[model samples]
Target: MLSTIVLAFQRWDGLSARRFTGLDNFAFLVKDPTFWQSLENTVVLFLMSTVPTLVLALILAVMLQSAVRFTNVYRIAYFIPNVTSLVAMAIFFSSIFSTNFGLVNAALRSLGIPQQDWLGQPWGIKIAISTMIVWQWVGYNTLIYLAGLQAIPKDQYEAAKVDGAGVVRTFFSITLPQLRPVVLFTVIMSTIGGLQTFTEPQVMVGNSGGTGQSGMTVVLFFYRAAFLDNDYGYAAAIALSIFALVLLFTAINWRIFRGRSEDR
Candidate 1:
């Protein structure tokens, strides 16, 4: 941590002598268009993945909680993706989203939809990376939600059932309200994970972030600067910016959830 802060002020290209540049790196960062673009892409990917991931995870958790047959098998199945190697997952998704001769395009063709390039376009790149992130993390989150569901008092559900409440009604009135804290935890954790996204995009699109840098993320941007470009000082500054962004978003999440609780 201290080294990063020091490096942020000193310019060094790994093999060269360290020269103190003070805020020069930061100033250049302010004027760097790619940095801003990467920031925007990061946020876009974060929202693209995090929202659907949590929603699907919560729904899966609810279903799993009610399962009576092959319960352990189902739980293991859902969690398999989380434990699988990320590189392998990225490669697998890359094949799935390939522009030509891919299952996704094939499926679209079968459904009478026009086949679209999944990795060659800007939006498609973001979607592909976000989908990979969701697939990787959703199972872990589902298990978290399942644990929270299990911890809820059985009496609350029994009372709702006795009152002739339907599954949908009970889920909203009883289940959701009780899971507020768990939901908040998941949201914050997702925010952190989303902002730090690196491997999927790097693997899927390469270090250049693909055409027009649409797939560039903050961490990937930093990695490119530090390693590929040998701009370690600038990379350090970028790292600090990433930290600040994560902190800001986390605080926002905390406040939003805390306010809801107070309102209740």
Candidate 2:
């Protein structure tokens, strides 16, 4: 596997490998407007999806931890999406976001609101893609958080109750602090997943990310460079750049969470 990969880099003629132009591809990527646009879109989607997903997952996990009825059934339902095929989900979402006769538009029309061309507009396409990502991953995160919540000793909550701490107070002061490591883990995982988002956007908005390339994630951009445009060297550089970005963002998340825990 390593030899095949190295040979692709060493002898690949598709990207003018005969002349080793060190950093040329990297320089082009730095100045590429499309690359920057994709980066911006990626960040926006990450923020939009990760924040809400984590918040909702935390809430759901808390509810489930309270000896709720049918807890096992709920767990299975939430985890179904994680086990389901992403490609199939993407395809399903694409049909739902169609400009005409889509479920969203039909519902809007029933409410006397104007229908939207979801996949035809840049921001709309982004929202659609982000929605899919959130829907699919929120359940998985919830399960992880639920596990973390279950691990917390019952004595802590019992003691908090005896000390006259309200439910919210105990949650904020006790539950949240204990879940810091789990939260950090989810954040880092989401960061890595968000940075490499490709299929939903690609399948939903097509190759160029619909209007103005709004839904074009960095991964899609890399795919285009390497496969569609046949620029192997540039694509490899973009891949490395993505790796660097993921590392940077993961480090930032870890530092922020670690600092917040220590501050408390």
Candidate 3:
């Protein structure tokens, strides 16, 4: 591992290896418009997935925890997508978002709306990627939340009920507070996953990341620069940038969750 790390920093046979560039590679990355664009795209996709995914997962977990009939069946159904092949799922999404024969376009046309060119537009590609992320991860998050919910003692709910607290009040006062650690775990994991998202977009939009490179995440950009374009120095710099971004976001999330825990 140490040798590999050293090798990454020192390019042996390339033009970049002739002399140490210090922080020049990083500086070039900052100046690159595509790098900035890819960063922006990653942030947008993260927002599109993280918020709704957590919210829906929490709701599903709570519902599943209740003694509803067929709860096991529901859990199995929700988790199926998470275990499915990502490439196959991406292909399925591609068909659903197809401009002409896609289910989405077909629905739009039926509603008297013009068919959208989903893969050919920037926001559209981001939305499509977001949809895939949400679909793929919501189940896993739901299971995490369900486990957290199960861990909460039943006596607490009984006590709240005896104190004349309604279900909503008890949920807000007891359930949510108790779930903080689980929520923090999910948020941190999601931050790491969101920052490194590549497969769905790559499969759905191909290696170039679709029209205008809207679907080109930081990792995808790094892959293209390093492997496809053979610019290892710049790719290493991009990799470090991605690492920094993930660290920054994860730290922010930890701070936020830590504060909430302290307040509780």
Candidate 4:
């Protein structure tokens, strides 16, 4: 963190003599259209990927918590993506979203839909990236939620049932409230993961970030600046920007969740 702050004030690549350029990097970030585009894409990816992941993970967790056949097998299957290499996963997804002969487009074509170049447009790139994000993290979030669900004593359900509570009633009146901590945990994790997205775009669209740089995320932008452009100071500013963004969102999340807990 300190290194980033220091780098913000100096105009030096990793190999160059350092020159003090205090506030110039920050100024450049504010004025750069690409930076703003990256910021927008980052936020969009964060929300689009995160909301679905939480809902899906919770649903999966609840299902797994119930009596089911081959429960361990199911869990392992879901968790494989989370433990797999992200670079490999990103590469695979690039193939899946490829323009001419991708799996996704092929499936769509089979359904009598027109094939779209998913990596060629802003929304398409975002959708592709978000899909990767959700697929990668949903299992991890599910496992965390499963742990939380298991930590909830079985007696709570029995007590709720004994008191004439239905399945929905038991879930809302006991399960969700008990899982509040886990919900908060997932939200915060999602916040971080969503913002720090890098590998997907890097491997999917290269540093150019596809058409109009739609796939350019903040971290990827930072990587471009630090490595491709050799603007270390600017890269440092972007890094600090990401740190601040994450911190801000995390605080907002805490407040929202903390208020919910207080209400409970």
How good is model 4 by TM-score? 0.96
Backbone clash pairs for candidate 3 read none
Off by over 4 Å in 3: 1-19
Model 3, span 22-67: residue lDDT tens = 6677777889999998899999999999999999999989888885
What is candidate 2's lDDT per residue for 1-264, written digit by digit as tens? 343234334324474535466556767888999999999999998998888889999998888877558999999999998888888998898888777878998899999999999988888888888889889998999999999998989999999999999988999889999998999999999999988999988888778877999998899998998789877767777787798899999999989998987887
Off by over 4 Å in 2: 1-12, 15-17
Q: How do all models score by TM-score?
A: 0.97, 0.94, 0.93, 0.96
lDDT tens readout by residue for model 4, 54-146: 999999999998946998898899899998998999989998999887999999999999999899988899899999999999998999999
Better of 1 and 2 by TM-score: 1
The order by descending lDDT is: 1, 4, 3, 2
TM-score, candidate 3, is 0.93
lDDT of 1 at 246: 95
Report the error of model 3 at residue 87, Å.
Answer: 1.1
Is 2 or 4 the stronger prediction by lDDT?
4
Candidate 1: deviation at residue 77, Å?
Answer: 0.6
RMSD of 2: 2.3
Instruction: List the candidate numbers ranked by TM-score, top first.
Output: 1, 4, 2, 3
